[model samples]
Target: MNNLGFFKNPTQITYGMGAANQLREIIDAQGFKNVLIITDGGIVKTGLIDQLTRQLDGIHYAIFDETKPNPTVTNCDDAMLALKQINADVVVAMGGGSSIDVAKAVCLLATNGGSIAGYEGIDTCSNDLLPLVAIPTTAGTASEVTTFTVITDEERQYKLTVGGIRLAPKWALVDPLVTKSLPSHITASTGLDALVHALESYTSKMATPISKTLAREAIRKISSHLRQAVYNGDNMVARDNMLMGSLLAGLAFNNTRLGNCHALSHPVSAIYGVPHGVANSVLIPHVMEFNSLAVPELFSDIAEDMGENLESLTLMDRAVAAVDAVKKLSKDIGIPTTFAEFKVDDSQIDRMAKDAMLSGNIAANPRITTYEDVVALYRKSIGGALVEVV
Candidate 1:
């Protein structure tokens, strides 16, 4: 293990059941006059926007709710236009990862005076972004506290990953109550996404003591509470635990980066338009099976955290049990195990593998992955074949 490690999380996170009610006060304390609310049509339709507006009765704000599930550069450009038109001093993102990612792109463009494409890689943006306050209505992505934003480029047919400490939100208001109204599928997909994040980060080559601690706890919380949260959306305790799990997973990945699961899932979402969480959910077990060859001890630790009884198992067996546990949990939560469920076929596997290899995340994977390895994993994922790890 490397003795030298680095950790950085500049976002001030406030988490609780009713933490969102303090939004107005938080904004006031930040001394912001005009706030631009970036979210999606679903959030507006659900009356969450109205509820927030009511809380900020005297605050000056404008709403831009055109964000899509997989946000595009056009979405960021439109939001930037809205921010400029309203002359907002601060930006508030009040939805899932999409809204927050759009807001991050808009904020980056607002101050940096350029298109989102220019800031695609790590530390590409030198200027400080406009102050951003993220309030998550879903328990996944944890875009609220992370330093990464994924914006799709429709013209190029790719998802652009923007990273740097400069991209971290100024504040994260995590209210589990906000996730209480999420649909079951959303809960299941997002919760499983959180689980994948924990598992991938725990075994990442960049994993540190700090990140591993957070990742292990996140795995435990998601394993114990994700099902209850999905089955009973009204269960505040489960919702709270899932939200905390998501946040901790975000923190882990934010510091240490992720692994093959995320590296591969990005291309699937970019090409197939699959929801990020669902794609990750489907690919995680397959990636785990492949990655365990490089990190069996870490996978064994994950098996224990996932509630697997590995009493008499060898390290390799325990690692396989971890993959099995993830598969079982994903199936129990109604996440499709095969890419065929999303209508993906083998035609695009080669191109997707190439794109997946381009992700910086591939370098952080515990295993030294090749283009051929990625192609095999993609095939295994699409065929729903649980190949044994050598």
Candidate 2:
């Protein structure tokens, strides 16, 4: 129905259990020497790092396993220094979102000759980054397949989204088995994170028929499989479904972009050190309730997809039901109900709201929101925020 459009996905993706074992072959195909592997300390403890090293043994790699949970510009700088010291020609991201983000920033800075901050808004970088391969250990934060990276600035106390197509990995290896060992809390949190991605993408202003298709399917998969996956870590079927859900949600948001939920969630994560998915879970339902009127049909569609009854319910009721479904899911998975539970203070609301407004995700919100909206949302999302919002 539309004439003009553009789609940008540069990563060559390989997804499955045991897929990471092909690292040597993937690296050989890329034809690069002197690679840098980026990951977090937790992954280093998981023995996957040893497997990765074994697969690519004697293949010229320097490990920089310091990608903190909320990766910062300082983290990237440190990784960059390490990469430069070793003269790495390729970057291998070997963990979840934080590791992938660090690798992306380092890869760009290696050739671009500047800090990660220099490439903040959009496709401002003209140079291509070093060939990078992403191995995601979590079923959430599909950072491996997307062009966006969130980096916190400690001095400024703001989480900024650094985006550019050049930041997309040259290859993405999504192996479900890597996620099997994640704790139940982590599985639940990341599963909710994937749900937020799907919901946000579905409600984004950039939503197209194609993106909606992916988003709806992602939502279905997460809703169906998340509880089982969280409860039974050994269930390969549940893990696989969660991974697929995460990947499809990544595909949807990568193209359609996200909205105000992500906008508000980023500040919470960056400032209070809340887990990324937990933060998103806290804000998503609030933002959804706020924006429900702006896009009722989309929300209604989501309600139907979540198996909520809409036969007698009005559009507003359906939207409310959708919000309730998200809240229920969060509760079932043991996600804390509010910012106060995360030890965030009431006085910090203004600072959080101010920073949230600066997130690029706000631009894609279906409804226009200002600082006031963000503040009110934060206020409503403190201890026991869910009941208050509903």
Candidate 3:
């Protein structure tokens, strides 16, 4: 309940069928002679990289496809080297969050000149990044529109945030047509990731009126359209809604930050190589349940946004219904089903919980989360079928 009446989104958002093609115009306006395209192997396989590069008729461009799923510190440094080799005057990140995150780090390092480790916490960068263009291929992470980049510090087994307005992309080109080729599982997991972003932001203690409105709409759009997006990747309407939902969620969370769900998920993915979205899916319901104790009315609002039938229910019942709705949604769309398949041991829970406790998101969580609370949540998330737990 932040009463300060503030909102900020510095990225110039461009969305439509051929938004990726708009990159040429953006680069031209910036008068950038050389362009560095940061992406992953998957995008190269999809031929999306080829499609976009073909549009860059006058600009010299090079592709660096070395980005990883987690976007490690090494990956950032590698991308930075690639940027230097090509002397790319502008950077275009043409994939999911991983690609965009790597691009962000590369841009930061190109000008900032230091280890990505030094800028871990927030607003630590002394200089503005190189001109960055984020073209999102997926609706999740919304790295296209965020000022923050999460680079994994593999040595420490932690996900580090390099934040502040300095990292915001100069342009965000969100094209639904580009997401048409996404595999079903990727669509499902990423859609859920967007939902968690909106939900956590909506229920955050730092949430402002503007963020709540954006988050509420994001929740509604994501909840209604996620199944369709997952089941029928050909549906353009569903893709539009999902990508818009992700954009809205990103805007919401960027201002409010996230909550215990994100805080807890970071450690799981950082430690076990679980997909960030899958890790978030496993922890979100339990985190929601924990936070519902503090804000049942807000949960009721979320339940309504999620299309739960709350006609004759008390606030608490509706709050509980929100959790149930999320669980059912995950089950229906084939998410939360992966956590059981991942290798996580009970012996590791304590250490993971300790890592979870270090997250700054804990402070913004709707509930005041403790170290013990994180441990209990991890065990609860693992209770059904998580393997190798003593």
Candidate 4:
């Protein structure tokens, strides 16, 4: 009870089936004359961009749809160039996490005047970014409401985290209808990413009562609705619940931060080019198992939230059940169960582990970690085995 904590959420979040319809009014209220819509090619192909533009009739805007699956520094540079060329007074992020992250980086660099690499650590940027409006089409990566953004550095092969409260969007329009069209695999991967966010935040060393409350609710919501959202993509109820879960997880982690799973997963995506959600999905269970040793009570609570029947179990058994439940959900949702499935090999583990150690998130991990522990976790994940941490 000696922990002192602080929470701040500046983004005004609106959630519902047609939340995107408010985009024009939100923009108009802010009096942004020129707008840049940052997104990916996939979202454009889905006609979501077209729908957004139609709704934003009479608003002067340009689209930069070159954002890649794992957004790179080059993507941010190109998008910033586009923003300047268009004289965009505001940025509208119109896709998933990649799109939102790209917009945040571009906005930060536009005002701050430097490469993203210069702002890799927490609170490195000294200036406020341009106004940003985020519309998340996926149910995970709640970048819309977060103080952090991840962008890849291709030359160094690392995912650099840029963080500060100034990076949070001014507004978040979370429309569940947009997620109804997500492919089953994308739904599963993103939903599980949100789940990991909640779990990690709940057990983080920085966890506060507020963060834990939101994290536990997020876990419960995701566990109840993620399967239905994955298998029945068009179910609005499931989609809405998943969206809320993701947003809550974002709020929780935005304050408490995450744990080793996120720290390790960032490197995996940066090196192997694995999708962020997929990388997180594959590593979450193993990280949970490794971390359970330090926070058995928290893990036991997670087990109950995830619907594990722990009535007759000891605290340690309940912790094991939590990890098992995560693995089961991931498998049932068709997430790749092993790092090997993503083409990661032992040869790359050492490099990834070293990069993972540099992550600011490692500081918040419930268990204090070492390079050897990270290497071991990487090997166990690749082998699809959950063994006791060495």
Candidate 5:
């Protein structure tokens, strides 16, 4: 790091107990026309979309509620078509990352006039996307605050990113109340995902002092609140803190990209159809273990942030405890510790490893990563027939 460090979070975040209800006022203030509310069917069934529409007394809006997990370019096309059908000028994404990612791509395609595949790399688009207002119903993903959107490209068998300041949501309405109805498993997985964000950003080679501070606090809050939030979803304090923690993590990683866990998990989820957070949950402990060699003291700090006590242990032992702490958290939250539970096909390892190394995230990892390192990590994460990476 030099005397000058960079920290950027472009989204205007409005967080409170009832922050989601302010959507109508924001839309009206902006004079946005024909709002397109993008979300998954689950959120539609939750009646959240209705709740949103009820607040918009006379706003013309349409709902595209077919966003799938690890949203694809196809989903973006569908959403763009829906936006075109209504000629919507603004978009309101009111679900997890999938819906928000689809909306971001739609915004890009609406203005840029190209397939989402063309804008796969960082800062690849020149034009500004459509006006976007993100309301995150889950504590994880934090797409509401991030400048990156991961869209699965089925043809490539990869999770493609369209990232830049232009992709950031104009506003993030983070209402903990919107998260009160989340099922326990979702609360767990999403919260765990937030933890991984903080962990990776905290130790990222690109981390700045500002990102580290936010990541550290995020780790502390998530470690303390996630278990309670998962087991007792109705607890408002736990929900609120989890949401806040997730927001902080998003803001942190928005500047400093995540490490091997995110890099590795993308291919796992794309290949096996495992949920993003669950795949990350299984890979995080291993990533921590691998990264500990590069920054042992940082790992120790992570352990302390996660509420683990070193109690006069060796320096290396303290670092190892960080990996242990992550594993314990996953087990306690019912996240699978291995890929076997997901029926991951080991024969896919070579292709997956190649794809994993292709991630831009690998450059930000604290450790010097090689294609061979990614192959080994996959073998360790997926303990099966383990065809040698050719």
Candidate 6:
């Protein structure tokens, strides 16, 4: 396979400052009724639901707002119950990846019938789901448009990606205005998440020309705008760029897939309750270092995209520059530089490593990795000390 393989994106995308307000008209045009609005509690507090409701005049609806930051299969069960009770014809998700993932799971299981785990891995669902509309509150994860939906199985203690074209949202309403009021820390973590998406996708074994193009642009936009978006939450220009970056990264990773950074980060999140973006931020530099040998040229391209020198430096040196740039951006935006900062224990490393190796994301890493590699990566991340590259 000298030439990169196939690529596809099936979601209907709408972008701009207030695109979410268009949800009702879009849903109506799709001939969907009895909408089930799924979200986390925080988004309800923002009163954006009121704006959503205003547009949904004739649509019958119900709200399920119990989604947590890391959505679990149990969350899907709860939402499914609500869907059945409400007899919802269309599922609308509002808020972060947790809510969106839950919505995706609910939509699938509602029609497909099984535990969310059965759909784990690729294209397991044989049937079409009810139409789903995704309206994202956070600019991270880009879960709104992607075919991937991660739901935790508490019994198994792993974050599983249940992916298929069937899980892709029928409509993706991206409204950057909703992000303008986000607090600084959230802006930092989620912004870093978007960066990780682009980086991982760019270096993924499955990378295609389309995905690479989108990932490169996503990396540049996120690197240039994430800090500004964090420092100045009200700056629409920064918010817009960050929003676009998050979407492009979502599109990129959705096709090309993610890598070891996400693989290692998942266990930290599953075991420690660390936010996904925060975990990615802490592990990205170390994982990049480990994988650099396999894809040095890719990292060199990444450095240039991140506005660093790529011409004179050797590939390894440029790889180091990429890591350095990520660290600097993380620090500037107040992202915790170490996993230990979250109060996770060294004793937990073995379990975390085992779980990381099982993540589907690990398979897409350019470098073939082992459980020992994941453990060392965890140890390196917990140390919080930056590595110096010669």
**Clash pairs, model 1 backbone:** none
lDDT of 1 by residue, 1-390 (tens): 565499888999999978888888887788888889999998898888888888777778899999999999888999999999989999999999999999999999988988898789999987999999999999899999999999998887899899999899999999998898899999999999988889888998888999999999999999999999989999999999999999999999998889888888988898889999999988898889888988899999999998999999999999999999998999899998887767887777877888889999999999999988998998888884333322
The digit string of per-residue lDDT tens for model 4 on 274-355 reads 8888888888888988999999999999999999999889999999999999889988999988766678877778788889
| Residue 108 CA displacement from its true place in model 3, Å | 0.3
Model 6 lDDT tens row, 194-261: 99999999999989888999999999999999888988888899999999999999999988889999
Q: How does each model score on TM-score? A: 0.97, 0.95, 0.97, 0.96, 0.98, 0.95
Q: Give every collision pair in model 2.
A: none
Candidate 2's displacement at residue 18, Å, is: 2.1
Candidate 2 structure quality by residue, lDDT tens digits, 219-332: 999998899899999999999989998998998899888998888888888788998999988888889989998998888888888888789998888888898888988999
Model 6 / residue 114 / CA error / Å: 3.0
Better of 2 and 6 by lDDT: 6
lDDT string for model 3 (1-390, tens) is 349667889999999988888887887777899999999999899999989989888778899998899889988888888899999888999999999999989899999998898898788988888999999999999998888999899999888888899999989999999999999999998999999999999999889999999999999999999999999999999999999999999999999989999988988888889999999888888899999999999999999999999999999999999999999999999886446688775767877878888888999998998887888888888884332423
List per-prediction Cα lDDT, in the order shown: 0.90, 0.86, 0.90, 0.91, 0.90, 0.87
Off by over 4 Å in 1: 1-4, 384-390
Candidate 5 or 4, higher TM-score: 5
Per-candidate count of clashing residue pairs (backbone under 3 Å): 0, 0, 0, 0, 0, 0
Which pairs of residues have clashing backbones in candidate 3?
none
Cα error of candidate 4 at position 267, Å: 1.1
Give me the overall lDDT of model 4.
Answer: 0.91
